[model samples]
Target: MIHFEISSYNPVLLTNSPLNIGVVETTLDALGERLLVIDRRGKVITQRLVPANNKLAIIVPFEYTVNNNLMCILLDDDAEKDGELVDNVKAAVIDMKNYTPPV
Candidate 1:
């Protein structure tokens, strides 16, 4: 499983939003929470009992490997007109350090 140690600097709720991702598991615990998981395809998985209001540190695990291939879909009009929006973009990969969860 792919483990992610998540830390939110701001008070952000893991809800269905443009900026927030979803959890994957459906089991609840004494803390009444579970990990929020999101895939590259934008699928959200979450625990059923974690109140939608509680926000805390979560560990997200994935059953499969992640594909980092970046794909961009442009509108037909933009593509035909040779829009400048796509010209300014470049894709690259950067190494990220694993964040250890606090005890």
Candidate 2:
């Protein structure tokens, strides 16, 4: 299993009214076939089966709002569990904040 986290280098970005969140692997290993994202309320917001890849960068796209406040819990599903099911450890936590470009 590989550990993962929000990329400290470029955690969150706002552009053209969309929020882009960056997730990176802490270890140099293959990201399994599944990736799970959940909210702070323990609600599974999005879950999908992704192709096996070793790339360190994973970007999650979300529609932006002015009062956006999100806590994203990422899980690496090594067990390949299907939709809305998490069978692996918590890989990372992404804390989101409202974005305001420099004036």
TM-score of 1: 0.18
How much is the lDDT of residue 66 in candidate 2? 21
Error of 1 at 94 (Å): 20
CA lDDT of every candidate: 0.31, 0.39
Which residues of candidate 2, in runs, are more than 4 Å off? 1-28, 54-103
Candidate 2, residue 86: Cα displacement in angstroms equals: 13
* Candidate 2: tens digits of C-alpha lDDT, residues 15-102: 4453334332322234455554554445554554554443333333333222233233334556543233323323332333443322
Residue pairs with backbone overlap in model 1 = 23-36, 23-37, 23-45, 23-46, 24-45
Residue 30, model 2: lDDT of 48
Candidate 1 runs further than 4 Å off: 1-37, 47-56, 64-100
Q: On a 0 to 100 scale, what is the lDDT of residue 64 in model 2?
A: 20
